[model samples]
Target: MRNVLEAKNINKYFKKPVLFHVLKDISFEIKRGEFASIMGKSGSGKSTLLYILSTMDTDYKGDLYLNEEHVTGKPSVELSQLRNKHIGFVFQFHYLLLEFSVLENVMLPAKKLAQLSHEEIEHNAMQKLKMLHIDHLAKKRANRISGGEKQRVAIARALINNPSILMGDEPTGNLDSYNAKNVFDIFKQLKEEAGLSLLVVTHDEDFASKTDRIIQMEDGHIIHR
Candidate 1:
């Protein structure tokens, strides 16, 4: 498979009264259509690493390449465009707008990109929701859905823009065991069906073990793969 994302000698530091290095010389590469998981204990910089890779936090030292384009140090506007066009993110909590229905929430990203007309957006949103088996909840308010359903809606929203890569930060953290398993299964199915690269940070070893590759982090560094 071709490389979709690559990071070399990545380092992240947090400074307040004192400086704390959260990631130390991290290097990794993810290929197209690959499913990989980052496993770590709390405070191990798992989410921090994902944020850096997702371009949500760029105050770090390293080289990052997405689809073979150098992404480090890009202007905020350019970075936002890149993220909007090529990347999708799923967080532990479903960050859907409580005021909108499932369909509207799924259409949010495409709306921001302004690349689709009203009909196109609605059609695409429904398609994604259907793909995730959540189309039946299209008219339900985001806040009214169950946790698993909410996560599914978030997944649908993430995929509505057809991003080439999906970054997940403990997506199943708030789910029960059954729901977590279902979410993982959905992720696997989406990775196969969409042909998109997946990089997930998961505390659940069982879930991580199901992925194609497992990256273990400790002391803010990748210790195993």
Candidate 2:
């Protein structure tokens, strides 16, 4: 299979009062359709590495490739476009617009991308919702759903754009044990049915172990992969 993402000798530093290295020459490749998790304790720089991979933090020193295309140091405008087209993100908090209906929230990104008409956007959004088994709640306000349901809605929204890679930071961090497993099952289902590559940062051992590979980081370096 082809590689979906590659990082080469990535290094990051932060300076508030003094220079501090946060990432130490991190490198890895994630194949297309593979599900992987990055695990590390607090201050291990896993989240910082994630931010770099997501193209949200470009201050690092290294090269990043997505589908063999070099994306490191790209302008923010171009990165923004790339993110909308190829990268989908899920967070611990659903971050859904409480005032908007489920369907609207899912359709929002695709609408901004404008690759499809209103009719097509709605159709695609509904299909994603159904795939997540939340179509019945499409008309409900985002705030009306339970925590598990809201997380599912967030996943549907993330998939609405058909991103090649899905990145999650503490995706299950906010859910209870049962709901965390539920989210993991949904992630697995999505990978099986949609062939999407996943990179998730999670502390739950059960959830991380279920992924195809585990990348463990410590003190700004990958200790295991």
Candidate 3:
């Protein structure tokens, strides 16, 4: 299978109070259509590694690639563009614009991309909502929805641009077991039905165990893969 994301010899340092190495020669790859989870205790550098892989943290030393294209050291504007086009993100918080309608929140990314017309973007937004079984909530104000609904809407927004990989930072962290399972099922469906690659950072042992692979980290190094 082709790699959707790869990191090679990644090293990160923090120069605050004292110079500290946060990541040490981290390297891994997520293949197309694979579902992988990163598991670690606090300070393990799992989140830090993810940020670097997501192309948002560029201060680390190493090589990073997305869809076989080298992305390290690229200009911010170009990296932003690549992120919009290739990656989908879900975080612990929904971060939706509460005042806007659900449809509008999902449409925002595509609108910023501007590669599609208004009508086309709107149509795609609805399709994503429907796929996530949240179509009925499309016209509701984002703040009016329940927590699970809000997270599903966030997932819809993430899928707006048809990203090649979906990255999550404790996406199920804020949910109850039932809702977390719902989110996990949705992710499984996306992997099986949509053939999307997934990389999730999770604390839930049950959540991590169900993924295809679990990458365990400790003290800024990968202990198991």
Instruction: Specify the highest-TM-score model's number.
Output: 3
**Model 3 per-residue lDDT tens digits across residues 1-225:** 899999999999999999999999888999999999999999999889989999999999999999999999999999999999899999999999999999999999999999999999999999999999999999999999999999999999999999999999999999999999999999999999999999999999999999999999999999898
lDDT of 2 by residue, 1-225 (tens): 898999999999998678999999999999999999999999999889999999999999999998889999889999988888899999999999999999999999999898899999999999999888889999999989899999988998888889999999999999999999999998898789889999999999999998999999999999999
Q: Kindly report which residue stretches of model 1 are placed more than 4 angstroms away from their true locations once superposed.
A: none
lDDT for each candidate structure? 0.92, 0.93, 0.96
Clash tally for model 2: 0
Model 2 ranges off by over 4 Å: none
lDDT of 2 at 174: 96
Best by lDDT: 3
Clashes of each: 0, 0, 0
Clashing pairs in 2: none
Q: Can you write out model 1's per-residue Cα lDDT over 37-135, one digit (the tens) per residue?
A: 999899998999999999989999999999989999999999998998899999999999999999999998999988879899999999888888889
TM-score of 1: 0.98
**Candidates 1 and 3: which is better by lDDT?**
3
**Residue 75 lDDT (model 1):** 99
